[model samples]
Target chain A: MSTDDVDAWVESARRGDRTAFTKLFRAHRSLITAVVFRMLGPTGDLEDVVQEVFIQIHKSLPDFRGQAKFTTWAHRVAVNVVLMHRRRARSRPVLVEEEAGGHEPDAGLLPDQDLSRQRRVRAFYRLLDKLSDKKRAVFVLHELEGMAPADIATEVDCPVLTVRTRLFYARRELAQMMHDEPALAGLLAELELAAEGQEQAADADEPARTALGQGRDRRSDP
Target chain B: MTERESHDNIELRPSSEFSARAVRHVVAEVVAAPPPELDWARLETRLLERLESERVTLRSTPPGSLGALFGFVAMAASVVLFVLGAGGPAATRAAATDQLVDVATLPVIDDALGAHSHLAASLAPGSALESGGAARRFVLPGVAAFMLAPGSRVVVRRTGEPYVLELAFGQVTAEVVPRHDTDAIVEAFIVESGGTRVAVHGTVFSVARSPERVEVEVTEGVVAVGPAGYRGDTTGHLLAAPSRATFAARDARLIEVYAPTRATMAAAATPRRDPASLLPAANPLGISRLAEPDAEREVHVRAASRQAPSAPGRDVRAEAVPQPLQGNPGTDATSPPAAGGEPSAAGAVAMSVADARAAMVSCLRRATANAPAASLSVSVSSQITVTLDGDDDVATVQFAPPLRPEIQGQCAGLLFGRAVAGAGSSFVIPFSSR
Candidate 1:
């Protein structure tokens, strides 16, 4: 959900409106899951992370200053929660990603057909997976999400220089991986062009996408 | 990337050859849509549990709002007024001078003396009575003779041959003489501001009473502490033997306790028949027992002031149906219906046993009185007689077999434990498997 919408719902939820809080959760559930799942991974228990994020928001909501957007703060909280879970599980790691099971979706692995647009998109994500957790996070936030390098560094609690270095390394690694694999590289190029075209289309549909993003931002705030 | 490009599937476009190549390779290896729809029921339950626990902790030590502090201060002031009393102007003036640092207002009282304004101190033959501030010491000639503190009262119904103190009060302690046969017994009590009273029999126990709560410690004997109520309530619940306690105003509970000594148990066991089996129906709250012959012995037990029916002589006898033993051998005797109709059958059995044991112990004394040199061990058996209240019909009678004195001692401990655990009076008697 957007900051304004979240701020509105938060004010109502604090007043004891249960429906407002549920509406908030339902609208933002997908965004929360995406953020949590990124840091936690498919096998990572994101429920705990999501719950912690909301609970922390609820507990600390009374202290919110409205200086920053609720979505920004929520993203920060989601990252912290997933990091904490990772730290706790590091000793006895139990990664249960769908890749290890028959339940794996068709979108996961590379297809052997003459590459389709969707297939190329899937291939690009496959390349992104090769980067380390920290580097991948920086790439997604900086290059993909276009978040400011300074803000990404602050969110990850790292030096801005480190965020830039990680992003640089991630991009270099992706370029090299694509170049080394000829067949995959051709598909990757097509996918990148298609993505650029979609961006144009999405900008044309900005008002609609903005509405969906705003709705999501609101629910995930608190 | 521009905002337009970033918001769209920028990496998935076919026009950007370099970005497309990278995106394809990334996508080829990227796992399926991440499993984001996690089962949250377990997390929700855990959060609820934590919420409940947090609430309880918060409630136990709630932050006092303005009115709450006022209530606390008011309650505290009232207690101080009641304890100091209107008559003690000098005490009140002195209290004002030391209001902040007065030992009386200390958050927690250390021992029996700190908790009570009135205290009973019984010194054995050689023990010295220490005079403290504001305390009026009562010196009894021997262990048998007892003293009552100011604002405290006790009734001594009878004195055993060896001399034992029968104590009932807000606070009292007796020094035990190893050579003597009796220990101090304190009964139904009310500590000025404290809600509970602890009664100890056949031991050296000290009690401290405060307005909101009472604390008791048995330095060397057995004690029973219960809640002696206020206004119209009298069924004071006992606060059982707590090794040490920091009681608050709402502390009224029944606790039964026994000091199990191998030597004492051996001595008690040597005696034939269970002393508890001989408990007297007349004194249901009896704590001490002695050998008595087939003669009259003075026994003291508490009944509601209303339960003591009027009679021409000390010996008042009334009859009712004796409760069936069921599986218990002597339970019927313990639970005989009172002479005047009252639902005290449950408590009566233990009281009756205490009385009968004391009576039987007196019988042994009588048996030895004729032959001073003979120290023959004696066991007493009692029978419960149930009488038809209205008519002169001969009701059924049940014989309660005797038990060894030591077994009675164990029963005393077991009973006290159960009573304390159940927070009730009357020995919550426990039985052995055998």
Candidate 2:
């Protein structure tokens, strides 16, 4: 949506227009839920946090200056809320349940393929949990969201070099963790073959070939 | 082989699909998870309910009649007369020079003063005042007027010196009347928060004490702010109007001064009804007491003022009275229709770039109407790449050149899991704030 559209709704909401505010909430709810979910994982109180975020947004809407996009400002609020949640959780002790045993492979897939992928994914999150907040945020933005270091830097309010350094460390740690797990090792082998197959497929398509070349060029840069 | 050797032997290409799969899993488990179904109607009802409650709280009347006002004024007059009549000439002189500030307006909260419910009493040195639920306004006649935010605790330090307000917690906004003469009676007013001290003579500012830092925002005049002990020393920074500074709780010496954003100035300028006007007219003896229950009196006064003939000078006051939000409360179906024709079950008709840009701009403008015009002046150009799911809902939103840190979170939050009106597809559109 255009900035003007967002601004008008903000104005309407500020004026106590419930419909406008609801529109704003509906428009941004998914994004906030996703970010919060990614940052804090699928906790039971996810909806509560989302509600708090919207309430805060409503309270603070009057002060929003449009210095940045509405979404950007809301994102900052979500991040701060996540950090605060972490802080509060740290102050008090809570019981954490151990992970349930691995799921059995469905009828279609090979037992190793299904179990290994699930295990690798679980192990990935575990490794991510070990990283510091800044590093994890940088890594998630860059690797998961397909954002560049500079973009991650902008989002996290850090220098590009810092983002790159954090991503590097996050990747190194995750790689080490994966190397230690035999299932993850097998998953890696499968992913490498899949990527190679896709690369060959892309070579046959002219646009994809160009995009792949451009991607290579970007990665090759300092 | 050593652990380092094994690590070196392993191929760890950062961009390999293994990393991709891990990221995909994380996304699937978190970002792509089905959000809990929100009962929008119920949520809206609850929100409106909360808003109504706040409005009522903010507009309620104090529990007393005009008789209470008269009785309070009579009692205060009797006390003054007793003091003057009983005091000898020398004692009367000392009493006249006493620098006690009066409570201009009692907060609406039930527990404003803890055990002491009455704010009709003057605030003396060494006296501490605490407020809950509602903000209390105190006036040092001709010196300053300060409103303490809810849940704030402030202490009036010893007299015969620069008036010192020790803030233990919460926020306070002070409007210090300028002293024209160099030898004014009140030499200075200082707000002490944590280890940071803000010294002022004539200024409108706010000081908020948070867990990690003390934030000072100056709106009108200059102030000297620094470590609490550096009273006359040059250890602190001089902050001018339209600026803010934060002092860390752990380190007094470290102060971060930031240029005031549009939001800062707007917050500092939030209109407050004059507490004196909310009270009944001053008594014949010129003593004004807190009589009105809540802000309802202010609203009545506003309604009365609106009925008066529109004198040329009254325009400013009319502008000052905040307008209630426009729109009927019951209407819920106000979402604007999509510009293009309705989407078929198979797929939405692709929106032309120009049409899409116009639609987006209109939406954004509506969303940010209340934002400061100056901050909105800069044209923001963005390229939004939207990936749609099979149902035509938005699965992802990516901005080119990346969004600013402040905007990214909101964009991600609102765009990631939304369903747009179209079949599964990926498209990029450029939008500009003009």
Whole-model lDDT per candidate: 0.36, 0.46
Q: Pick the DockQ winner.
A: 2
For model 1, residues B360-393, the per-residue Cα lDDT tens digits are 2443333323422457533333322211111121
- Once fitted onto the true fold, the runs of candidate 2 whose alpha carbons sit more than 4 angstroms away are A1-6, A66-69, A87-91, A97-123, A145-147, A179-186, A189-222, B1-434
* Best by the lDDT measure: 2
Q: Which ten residues in a row have the lowest lDDT in candidate 2 chain B?
A: B69-78
Which lDDT value does model 1 have at B303? 25
Please report how far candidate 1 places residue B242 from its true position, in Å: 43
DockQ, each predicted model: 0.05, 0.06
Report the error of model 1 at residue A3, Å: 7.5
Output the chain A TM-score of model 1.
0.58
Ten contiguous residues minimizing lDDT sum, candidate 2 chain A: A88-97
lDDT of 2 by residue, A1-222 (tens): 677888999999999897888889878887877676666653554655676677668878889988999998898787766654553332111124333212222435577754554565556666777676777777666554445566567777889768767766777677666766665666667778888999888777978878989999999999
**Candidate 1 Cα outliers beyond 4 Å, as residue runs:** A1-8, A12-20, A87-91, A95-133, A143-145, A177-222, B1-20, B24-434
What's the TM-score of chain B for every model shown? 0.25, 0.34
